[model samples]
Target: MARADGPRTANGPRTGGGPRADGPGTGDEGPVGGSGRRFAPWLPGVLIVGGVAFDLSTPPPYTAAPFLAAAPLIAAPLHPLRLTALAGALAVAAACLLAEFHGVRDWAQSATEIATVVTVALLALLINRIVRRGSKRLASARGIAEAAQRAVLPVPPARLAGLDVAARYVAAERDAAIGGDLYAVQDTPHGVRMVIGDVRGKGLGSVEVVAIVIGAFREAAEQEATLEGLTLRLERALQRERARRADIEQAEGFITAVLAEIPRGDSQLRMINRGHPAPLLLDGEGAVRQADPEVPALPLGMGDLGAWPDRVEELPFAEGVTLLLFTDGVSEARDAQGTFYDPAVRLRGRRFAGPVELLDALVADVERHTGGGTADDMALLALRRAPVAPGVDRGR
Candidate 1:
């Protein structure tokens, strides 16, 4: 079956208001105010007032010096440098007032406390400068990660060969935008080919593997006519990558992936699984089942461990049916009580309008299950066969 053609690529750099692969954010909101930002305007006031009350209620030796000193340091990261300086001035002024009220202005302890406040206020200003510099560096790092993510996993076109498609990726580390999880979709001579996989390990090494696998897939998906042939190409690609790295990575590296093909004008889907989690097959009635492989297989890059022929599992891909693919991050997400999330159980009996809706709901459900924090990178792809429009030709 040949690919049904229109626009082959949908997810790219946003142009003329097209959907963005990286989502929308200007990166302007920093450690400053939202709810926490609101507290900044009054935090120094509360600290100063509390300190004054403490000094007044206690003896001369019992000073609010510590609170007076802390006020400015606390404000440094949450407010502008000017505001931080103002906070320090308020703390110092509060200390002076307390010293006068207690009639201890001439005492050595009072003088010591005044000097401490002044010195700390100056130190707080320095801390503020350091923090601002770090924030700028952090923002730059985030920008680089975002760019790498977009390049490694360009967004799948929203519509591919008449299928409604959407993909989402969530990195385990919130600030780290890219990780080992990967997905790719391409219109090839055979069909609309797609792959979702997770590389073992983390950090720059895993990201490097992700880039290599994706680059290989985009090139080989067009040439390999059979799913088995495509799987072999990927295996060789990873093995070659491992050979260039140190012996430790070569010994430890492996990837679990599922490659799939949806042919035009056919109600059948072909898949090759390499020890990855099974893709979920969802029907319009909201029933869900795992598209488990007919034969078990080892993960890619582990060819030396064992030799087995890669098998292709063909399944029904009926109208209004959706295929859901994901990495282990979705399955292994744990709740506070130490319970692992099972997507099969959670998605049963739940109907979605389309692939985009299913992903939004699934991601939200996982967040609620794991209390909004997952320890592994997540990559998800949903492809659905749109119901044929009335009076439209069944065979194109």
Candidate 2:
């Protein structure tokens, strides 16, 4: 596949969830947690007051110094610098008051207790500053990563050509915005062509392959006359990428992908599967069918192992029907009992108004199956052919 250097343009509005654009770790906002986050600011005061009560109730041999020392430390990461300083001062004051209440019979012991509190308080202030600095740095890094993900996988338009479309990318790691899974859809001269694939690995290496695959697909989708040709183009792009990266070649990296095309004014869809999960088709009557390949082919980037001509299969794609494509993340997702999530089974009799509704239901079902967590990232694409209106011309 030839390398595409020119920038690509999106056909419609982008729709998908990604990293928080508002940013994280802001001082005004409480740290991430449950109900405890709401009460975090009060914890230091509670600790200080509890320490005084413990000191008074406990035998003189057992000092509450440890409890007092913990106050400011607890406040450091959760509260503002001023609040942390106030917590430190409160802890020190409590320590001194306790020391005086117990009497100054041992001046050395009293002085040592007070000194420890003071030292701990000072350390807490330093820690507060360091934590704030680190939070800011983390926020900056997250912003850059989000930007990179958007650039690599620009969100597909909600509508492409005459079909209603929706795409989603869900990363396994909470902090990650992108992963090995990728999807792209574009309007071409032949029809609306799209691709969804999963690179072998994860992290930056996988992201690089994602970029290459998408770049090649965008260019090939417009130029290639057949789905097989587009698949070959993507295969060559990965091959070229592997040749340049020694590590990828050594690892024998490959991408499981499916190339799809819907010719203009046609009621059929053509697809070429390359060792990837078969896509699901939902007709207007709420019937589901798996668009499995007649002849299985190896995934792209494995041409070195064996080579065969790509085969494009045609499937019925009538009006009001939706096609759903996704990576292994969805099919392989396991519940606590190790049961895999079967989309076909879950959506067999469920009818949806549009592609967006279909995908929304599918994603929600997958999250429920996996208990809101999965071992791999997921990329989903749904396309629906709009039904013809009464007395309207079929041809545009």
User: Which candidate ranks first by lDDT, i.e. highest?
Assistant: 1
Q: What Cα-based lDDT does every candidate model obtain? A: 0.82, 0.81
Quick one: how many clashes does candidate 2 have? 0
Per-residue lDDT of candidate 2, residues 254-367 (tens digit): 899998999888999999999999999989888999999999998888888978899989988988889999999999999999999999999998889888888889889999
lDDT of 1: 0.82
Worst 10 residues of 2 by lDDT: 1-10
In the range 65-144, model 1's lDDT, one tens digit per residue, is 66678788877886789999999999998877766655542455567778888898999999999999999999999999
**C-alpha RMSD values across all candidates:** 16.7, 15.4
Off by over 4 Å in 1: 1-41, 57-59, 391-396
Clashes of each: 1, 0
List candidate 2 segments past 4 Å from native: 1-33, 250-252, 391-396
